[model samples]
Target: MQRIFANRARTPEGWLQDVIVSVEDGQIASIQAGQTPQPQDRRVDILLPSLGNLHSHSFQRAMAGMTEVRAAGKDSFWTWRTLMYRFMEHITPEQYEAIAALVFMEMLEAGYASVGEFHYVHHQPGGTRFETMTELSDRVFAAALKTGIGLTHLPVLYTYGGAGEQPLSGGQTRFGNTVDSFAELVTQARAHASRILPGDARVGIAPHSLRATSPRDLAEALMLKDEAPVHIHISEQPKEVADIQTWLGARPVEWLLNNAPVDTSWCLIHATHMTDKETRDMARSGAVAGLCPITEANLGDGPYNGPTFLAEGGAYGVGSDSNVRIALTEELRTLEYSQRLRDLQRNVMIPGEGSVGAAIYLDAARGGAQALGRQAGHISIGNLADLVALDGADTALCAVEGDQLLDALVFAADDNVVTDVWSAGRHMVRNGRHLEREQIVSSYTRAIRSLIDAI
Candidate 1:
């Protein structure tokens, strides 16, 4: 058993001082406030429940800066995606693993304790399968183990290249899979994760998006879904929404709500474009809106309907989609700022009154844990000990207390203010640095060098 003594810690009931939290076998055993710290206790100034990155494509981290060039015409998400597909085709399995390790390490340092890796790259270039079908998934697990971050491995089932059941072509060929094969892949991934990853690690399914899978394929994929999470991309781009509406005869969110079992177990990634009706209905559906503000901004995806969604009691969580920038504070900051910029108002995330930072931060912690099927979110007993500690001494967080501390974290500080992090009691980060950062970064540098040469 290990103990953490925090001068101030956020609990489910409220903020408490001089808190002592005990961890036994990765689960939080007890939390007592106004307690004396033992000599062996790990100490920190400010402790908060670390947020999970609810969506990611870890392999895309390597291509972050390469996509920023303006295309010949007006650059759009589709054009950015075409370049992404071409870049991914050159990534070998070893390079993919290296890139995942670097991304996971970066996530830990960025105060994201766990990640919902929406893995889609499966086959070799030209749609050829490896002798081991689970090669890429195993690579993800290996990277997770190397980094000691909590893993929710979401194996993506991408059946088609585009809307209307378009056949797989070009770079998308790597992600194609039949329903039966996808089921087997999920099964094998579950077994692989169980064997190697920690007890809290999970295997989930992602049916790519409404555009990538037909109704029949999606239904069959959902049939393969077990008790774990089910995520899907939806309504990120105007073109995507228009295409989905034209092909399916309804908008993406509308069709999913009417067609599938859209519930709390589902995390709809990037429901950015939606009607007023679709927003309210989706909020009422109990599914998490997995927002990736940084990537959305990078790809020119529009802002989500924040006010309407929150008014309807919607749940939302932040993610570093595309792994473009993996800063948790910036993600939350961008989310609130997006709302502010859109509505032309201040402190827009909370419904009535209170700190906007605390509202979004705590809600994201809970929603992210729920989305990844992780028993964490609160600093409470019986939950997994997924936690982060901030340096109160930092200039950005100095002289702040209560909700102001969170406000500073979201609005003022960078990820450098994150001093320590634990994912399910695995203390992989200390003093704002992941323990294995040097080696992981070296491997990634080598991989990226080789990948650049290959491309």
Candidate 2:
């Protein structure tokens, strides 16, 4: 089947006029500029490559609004984790699949074509393993398959509760595993997911955080570095920085840059707390900083120094880390907005002479592709046919072209303008709605209700 997209706003070569994109066999066959659409071609108003969510914890989507209430003292990421652990107690494989399907559907509606799921929940509530260790991972793949989204399945290895090889806390039991066990789990996940969607699904490795893995375990996990992309949670909170200093006499990102072989294949999530030296080192290493702006704001995580990082040529991509909210526009907006608040300057993200929104969107899209180890984040030839068509007739987007269209989409518009979405040439969302949203949401609602009742 061949389909063509016409009247795109932005492309690799800036704004194209009367462009036509051809897709065949789930890959972009050709992209021709100044071409009129044939009778058989599908015409769209505004076309752009869909985004890749570089970091996510899909099952955490169910815990979105449940942690909003103020706990005993000052609420923080640590308090949120307690609620998250409580929520994890009731998530069966079926519930996990349902929740993840709903979350992925939301991602499609929000203009993300793929997601890097930083999955770590492995065992039953009491740390008991299922007969098949890959049961949870199978559920994740099932969700992606049903939702028509590309997946970088990163199974996390969480050993200790914190730094210094601490024993696993009660709430952290389900996420704990030895390095050997994690290697076996990844092997199982790769083998099982291969039958589902071979090329569309990637199995990666993630050591939960510096606090959770010892130097030896972290080194062992890096042995799989050549096999797939490696991701990890770095210094997101000030306490985490203090803890790292206590344990290793250096910050998390600083230590990782010095110890680990940080490269393009690595994505350090929440390198939010870093010194000038650490930032410069990360920029030179070509590793991606997986920023989740919305989640960071929700958790009161400090803002990332976007200007300095970009000035030093650091790469970054956005994510829906906790799945608390899954809007590409909101993530981009929050990222810029956070920077604006920090720097007290407008248009701080744009370096050269172009639209700030377009620059940010394109950089994130490209960096996200590198982070996920996929030839995606563009609608060019030979790339996966993951595309998004915005409603060009929207009043806010009226008179928008090139970078202006990107600016409108990221700033003025939300998911409502995203009229169509295709992941790997499959129309997962049309008319601004996910194909299976009703059914998926119904199942998710039931599962979440049951979990809440059980708790």
Compared with the true structure, what per-residue lDDT tens digits does model 2 show for residues 47-132? Answer: 88888999999889888888899999899999998888888888899999999999999999998898899999999988999899
In Å, residue 216's CA in model 2 sits off its true spot by 0.3
lDDT of 1 by residue, 49-130 (tens): 9999999999999998898888898989989989999999999999999999999999999998999999999999998998
Worst 10 residues of 1 by lDDT: 64-73
User: Which lDDT values do the candidates have, in the order given?
Assistant: 0.94, 0.89
Instruction: Please give the lDDT score for candidate 1.
Output: 0.94
Q: In candidate 1, how many Å is residue 213 off?
A: 0.4
Clashing pairs in 1: none
Off by over 4 Å in 1: none
Error of 1 at 64 (Å): 1.2
lDDT of 1 at 205: 96
